[model samples]
Target: MENRLFYVMFCMILLLSLCSSENYFTKNVKGEGVLAKNSYVNHPPNPPIVEGPLVGLTRKAYQYNLTLIDPDNDLLIGYEIDFGDTIEGSSCCPIPSNTTLTLYHMWYNPGVYNVKARTKDGHGLWGNWSTPLTVTIMEGDTVPPVVHMLKPNKGLYLSNKRILPFPMNLVIGGITVEVEAVDEGSDVSRVEFYVQGSLKERDYTTPYSWDWYEKSLGRYVLTVKAYDFVGNQVSDEIIVWKFF
Candidate 1:
C-alpha cells in the first residue's frame, strides 16, 4: 500500500508539470501570433497632402484636392477637412492609395484662413492632421495697380546746350527718381525700385521716390514695381542715359 501510494503521488506530480508546460507554450504562441495579427489591423493612414489655390474671391466656391497614402496599402476610408472658419466637413467611402479626394468650400467674408485635413484607413484609425494651408480671400480685387515712372523722362537732354557741343552725350550730375502708382480697388501698399537688376529702394507711402546722390554714368535701366493692398503688382521700367 505504501509503494502504490507513492506511485500514485508520482503520477499526479507529473501530470501537474505537463499541464503547466502546456499553459506556458500556449501563452508563448499567443504572444508571437498576436503580434503578426495586430500588424495588419487598426493601423492609421498617413497624413494627407492638400492642394488648392492660395487666393480666392469671397462668395465664390473653391475646389481643393487631397492626396492620401497608406503604408500597409489599406483602403482609405474617409477624409475630414477643417476650413478654420468654425466649419468642418467629412467624406466617406473607401478610396485607393494615391487617389485624390475633391472638396469644395465657400466663404462669405474676406479674410485669411487656414485649412487642414486628415485621413482614416479602413480599420477606422485616424491619422495625424496634415500641415495647414493658408488661403486669402479678397473682395473681387482683380485689377492690378497702375504704375509709371515720373522722373528722368525718356530723351531728356541733361547737358547744358550752350556749354556742350551738339551730338555730345547727355551729362547729368544727379537726379531724383520718382514713381506714381494708382490702385482703384485698393490702396497702394508699397513700391520697389530696382536699378540695374538690383533692388535699391522700397517705399511704403505716397510720394514714392528715391534721391540718388551718386552720379551715374552710361546707360542705366531703372525699374519700378508697385503693389496694392491685395497684392496685385505692376512694374514699369525705363532706359535712361546718364553722363558725368
Candidate 2:
C-alpha cells in the first residue's frame, strides 16, 4: 500500500516535468535557449547599381533601379525617393501597381542628407519608409591627364642579334629602358610609340628615312608600349644596341 502511494507521487512529478511553462526568452533546465526570428516591422527595398547611401554633385543627376519585394499578389500603388534636402528636380507619381519601380532624379543639394523611400500596396497598406538612402553633394576635379615616358622607349622594341652576324667592336650598343602610363576611361582609344633604344637607327616612325646611325659611345635599348584609355598597358622592347 505504501509502495503504491509513492509510485503515484513519482508519476505526478514526472508528468509535471514533461510540461514546460516558459516563454521564448527563457532558458530550459538543460541550458539551451529557444529564440524567435527578427520581426520585420519596417524593412526597406534594395536598389540596383550604386548601393544605398549614394553621393553626387548638386547639378548632376543619377538613376536608381528600385526593386520592391512583393510578399502578396497585391498591386503596388506608388513609390518615391525622398531627399532629406531639396533636390533640383525631384519628382514622384503613382506607379503601375507593379512589383518594380525605376526612378530618375536630379538633386540640387546645398546640404548633406538621409533619403528614404515609401510605397503603397493595392490593399491600401503603406509600407514603412525604406531604410534611408543618403546622398551627399560635393565638388572636386574630374579630368584625367595624359601619360608619357621621360626617357627610353616610351615602351616599344625587339630585335635578333644572331641575324646581324656582322657584329663590330665599335658597335657599343645593347641597353634597355622602360615606359609606363595611365589614363581615364575615355578619349583617344590608345597610345603606341617606338623607342630609339639601339645603335641601329634614328627615329623609327618615318619609314622612308631609314637612317642607321653609328654607336660611337654606348649601348641603347628602346621599347614601345600600347595603352587603352582605361589605363590598360601592353609593353614590348627592341634591342637597338646589343654589343656581343
Candidate 3:
C-alpha cells in the first residue's frame, strides 16, 4: 500500500510539472494566448443602383431612385451623384443601409448628360461608383434632330472623327468646324457650338460653319447642340487636339 501511494504521488507530480512547463512556454515564447480574443470583419458596401429617366425636358424637375446594399449589413452613411455637367450633389445626411432613396434635379440647358452615384458606409468608407445612366435633355422636344460633323474629305473620310481614338504624332493648329443639321418635322431653328463644355458661338442659318481658332495647345471636346422650330433638339460631340 505504501509503495502504491508513493507511485501515485510521483505520477501526479510529473503530470503537474509537464503542465506548468507548457504554460510557461506558451506565456513567454508565444506571448499570446491560444484562444482568440477579439475579432472583427468589415467589407465595403456594394455599388448603388440608380434609376431615372432617359430623356426629359429642360427646366423640368426629374426624380431619380438610388438603392444600396452592404454585404456585411453595415449601416450606410450617405450618397453622392455626378450630374455629368461638371456639377456634383450629395445626400443631406446619413441613412440606413439596404434602403431606397429618392432625389430630384433640373437641367436648364438641353444636351446629352450622364449621371452616376455612390454610397458611403458607417465606417466612412466609400464604395465604387455605380454604373452611369445616360440622360438626354431636350427643350420640350419630342423628335431629336439629325446632325453630323463634316470632315475635310466629304466622301472618303467619315464625319466627326473622334480625337484620342489613337495617338497621332502630328499636331493640329486650326480646323474648320462645320455641321449639317436637318429636321424632318420642321426647319432647323439654330445651331450652337460648345468648346470644352462652354458655349462659344451660334449660327442661325444654313451652311453652319465656325472658324474655331486654337486658343491654346491642348485637347478639346467640341459639341454642337441644335434645335428645331417645334422645340425638338439634338447634339453631337467630337474630340480634337491643338498642338500649335
Candidate 4:
C-alpha cells in the first residue's frame, strides 16, 4: 500500500513540474495559452488612394497625392510607389495615419502609365497596392509654373525682443508677402496667396504680392500657388511668426 501511494505522488509531482515549466501544454487550453505575451494577429492596411492629372508630358515632373488608412489604426511608416515602367520608388519615414503625401515623378518615354501606391504599417507589413490611376503621357510642354517666395526668405529675425531661430522669419505688426512666378509653356494666369491654408488674396499681374495685416499674433503658414494658362500649377510656401 505504501509503494502504491509513493508512485502516485511521484506522478503528480512530475505532472505539476511539466505544467509549471515552459512546456506548451501548461497554458495551452482551448488555444489561449499558445500565444506569446502582448502578441496578436496582424492585419495589413487598406488600399491607398492615388490622385493626379490624367494627361502629362514626357520628361516633365508632375506631382501626385497619396493617402492611406490602416484597418487596425496602426501608424504608417513608409510607402512604395510604382510608376508601371519597371521603375519603383520608396519612401520610409514615420507619418501619421490619414495624412496626405505629395510625390513627384517624370516619365522619360511617352506612353500610357499606371500609377499605384502601397503603405507599410508600424508592424512592417506592407498592404496591397491601390487601384492604378491611368495617365497618358505625350510629347508637349506640360511643365508646371515656377514659383518662389520673395519675401520672408528663410532667415533669422527679431520678434517681441527675442532672437528667433535662423530658419524662422519673424514679422512685426504687418508684413507684405511677395512671390515671383514664371511659366515657360504658357502665360501665368494668377497667383493665389494663402495664410494658414486660407485664401487671402489673388494677384493677376507680375510682382505678385499681398499685404497681410491680421491682428492675430502667432505663427502662420504662407503659401503662393501659381497657375498657368494651360492648367499646369505649382506652389511655394513659407512659415513666419507674426507679433503685433
Top candidate on lDDT is: 4
lDDT of 3 at 169: 22
Output the number of the TM-score-best candidate.
Answer: 4
Identify the superior model by TM-score, candidate 1 or candidate 3. 1
Which residue segments of model 4 deviate by more than 4 Å?
A: 1-39, 142-244
Model 2: per-residue Cα lDDT at residue 183: 42
TM-score for model 4? 0.45
Compose the digit string of candidate 4's lDDT tens values, residues 1-244: 9999999999999978866765534256575655344435689988889999899887677899888788888888888888878545565677777888888888878999999989999999999989999999988657899999977676544433334546678777666777999998867989999988999899999889888777658888888999987567999888887777
Q: Model 1 over residues 1-244: C-alpha lDDT tens digits?
A: 9999999999999868855552322234446522112222356778899999999886567899989888888898778888878656565678898888788887767899999888888888889998999999888766789998767654344442223343433437666777889999767889999989999899998899986656677887889999987667999997766766
Give the alpha carbon lDDT tens digit for every residue of 127-174 in model 2: 666676767766522334344443333222222122233332123233
Go through the candidates in order and give each one's C-alpha lDDT.
Answer: 0.77, 0.46, 0.74, 0.81
TM-scores, all models, native as reference: 0.44, 0.33, 0.43, 0.45
Q: Please say which candidate is ahead in lDDT: 1 or 4.
A: 4
Could you tell which candidate, 1 or 2, scores higher by TM-score? 1
Root-mean-square deviation per candidate: 11.7, 17.8, 16.9, 15.8
Over 1-244, each residue of candidate 3 has an lDDT whose tens digit, in order, gives 9999999999999868866553422233558644332335678888888899999887567898888788878888777888777555564566677799887887878999989888888888888998889999987545767988763222212223434434432235555678999987666889999988999889999898787664557766778888887666889887665555
Clashes of each: 0, 23, 0, 0
